[model samples]
Target: MELLSALFLVILTFLVVTAFYHKHLMAEIPPGFIQRKKLCFYHYLLNFGFVLAKTSEKLGLASEIHVIRTIMNTVPPLKDKHLFIKDVRFEKIKVRIYQPKIPTTGQRRGVLYFHGGVGQFGSIRAYERTCCYYARKSDSVIVSVGYRLAPEYPYPTQFEDCLAATIHFMRTAEDYGVDPTRVITCGDSSGGTLAAAVAQAMVNRKDLPKLRAQILIYPFLQAVDFNLPSYQQNKTFPILTREQILLLGLKYLNKDVTLLNVLFEGAHIPEDFQLKYQKWLSPDNIPEEFKPRGYKPGKIIHPLSDELHALTMPTFDPVFSPLIAEDTVIAQLPEAFILTCEFDVLRDDGLLYKKRLEDHGIRVTWCHLEQGFHGIVFLAPLGRIVSFQSGNKGIKQIIDFLKSI
Candidate 1:
């Protein structure tokens, strides 16, 4: 009886400490945020889980990512009478394919989806409902790539896996009753980064069937400048923050997290490279309307150390920063559907990429959610408690675009 009481006291102490720390770090929900009350509850629950994961990691019971992935993957797969879902491998990479049950006159469009989690925690299992919804609504086959994540697979592996799976799917698309020529690449957040990179990489390939379109849902496209107007406006917004992005990015790249502050200050980019890319990356390219929240131009506060530049140089590559791709490559790419959220730090990344595509005469469809936040689309299908109307609107916009094409 005494031991049981002692254990209960320890659990209570941990819970109290976790709650206090979460409150300390939690950002205030903007008054205009969609479903502010629901957002608050969801954020707190998420933060509490994160605190538990961190504590578990410190106790050597499990890795933080393992705990988080377990929690996220615990959502039971959605059973839909209108969809047929199966697990398969494309070039040995795990993937879940979702197809409509209803018959069609001809082959349907194919979408290769890569889920977000900054290339760290997301899984095909976690995004089952999302893929099922897309397949049923768009009346298209959806392929959710389960690319190998970081701290195990490391940099370039995620991109390599995504590209490999896409190529394999393009080759075998006919087997699944999908039209190869009409295949699309779509993803959100880091997955958005992969989709953009895959699309850019495929632009010059002559053997593969050309992609019909690419959809990037609030993607992070550049590392050179994190001080864009959206970043300044939404740095403290929940679901995702500027600091979280950089830390996750470093973890994805297997870089030292201590360099995050320097990267945030814009010291990782060399002066010459900055000048060369300024035309495409400069905030001036963003329309004035986006600046109503207020934005000030930022200058590099410190010189780029050679060590820092060498360590962080991969971030500036066009493969990583699709916004920095060459005009020739951009011109040949397929039509694009880019979505941005008003409260997302990466909103300007989508906006800037849209401008680059337009400048190169590529057709682009852009959607901006004034009240939406990052990860809204994925959260929408989770259940009513965390669902937001803006998320449903965003998903509808995507489906409408898919059907139109």
Candidate 2:
């Protein structure tokens, strides 16, 4: 009877979560819904409290990526110091720099920041506060790369742009009061993905100074298996979802939408490829403990389709999945400061990458937030919405790691 009651509660919570997500899911929200914009912000901010008070139980958070984005957009921009924002065209690529006036002793470390939005719909604006805070806290020079986005500037372009900007900075670090030797490459979300990829690429370039460190805040690492423990358990998580992930994959590659069905069936990756990469992407790679909440290895698809396999080629390329880089390259990487959230679908990506880094003798400083969800880092103290403690803690954790080095 007790077991039955627990199962019922889980089922009920899932029902509510799914219903809420679907309400905001329909490709994009219609403009008619804009009339309720104010209400929506309050609803999301007070959602957990609302569920607690009314249901006498905690309501699972909904994973509405665009909805959260829309709500965040509605907030009046917090007053920031007058930033002389300029887009400097650096040898064909463009980059935006943010600096606070305070001279450094020797040269300070230069941060090549990559913004995250699944390689789409994100810009320097999304991470305004973050860049500001880092500048004020670390007293370092911060350059936020507004790399090209998907469906607008497709695969390889964004990565190439980030690489170009980073290399240009390393060459001209002296002009910006930055030490070439102490530079860092960092980013969040898909930005974190870009940071890691750029870091690996830097390792191969003997022309550049070695990176001081790489800070990856819950980066999305692999695309081989969307059925990992984290994906299955947090399949419907807000801010990011399994369905939305596939959508972004298509958008990034400019792939045909008609193959979406086969893509979802694990058909995008062929049998031999799956077998070869499963060691790295498998749920088995994740520990048994992470499965406590809920996790089940998905059913295998014997025959995958060729049409589904085309554009997805970039998914496993070292440029996209730095975690898939060769061991020799991984070993040479700077020490890592990694942050992972228990409720995020990309949690396992971080975990697997952490393990690989450790296996390669790379020192890793890891901070895992058990109760936090994805995108909490971007929501610090902005009214009725309370910041996730882990987000702030995660930020401090990375700062601490950077300071230690």
lDDT of 2 by residue, 109-133 (tens): 7788898777765666666677767
- Candidate 2: C-alpha RMSD to true structure equals 10.6
lDDT of 2 at 228: 80
Query: Each candidate: how many clashes?
Result: 0, 1
Listed per candidate, the RMSD to the true structure in angstroms reads 2.3, 10.6
Task: Provide the overall lDDT of each model, using Cα atoms, as 2-decimal numbers.
Answer: 0.89, 0.73
Q: TM-score winner among the candidates?
A: 1
| Root-mean-square deviation of Cα positions for candidate 1 versus the true structure, in angstroms | 2.3
Model 1 spans > 4 angstroms off = 1-27
Candidate 2 stretches with Cα past 4 Å from truth are 1-87, 381-386
Clashing pairs in 2: 63-238
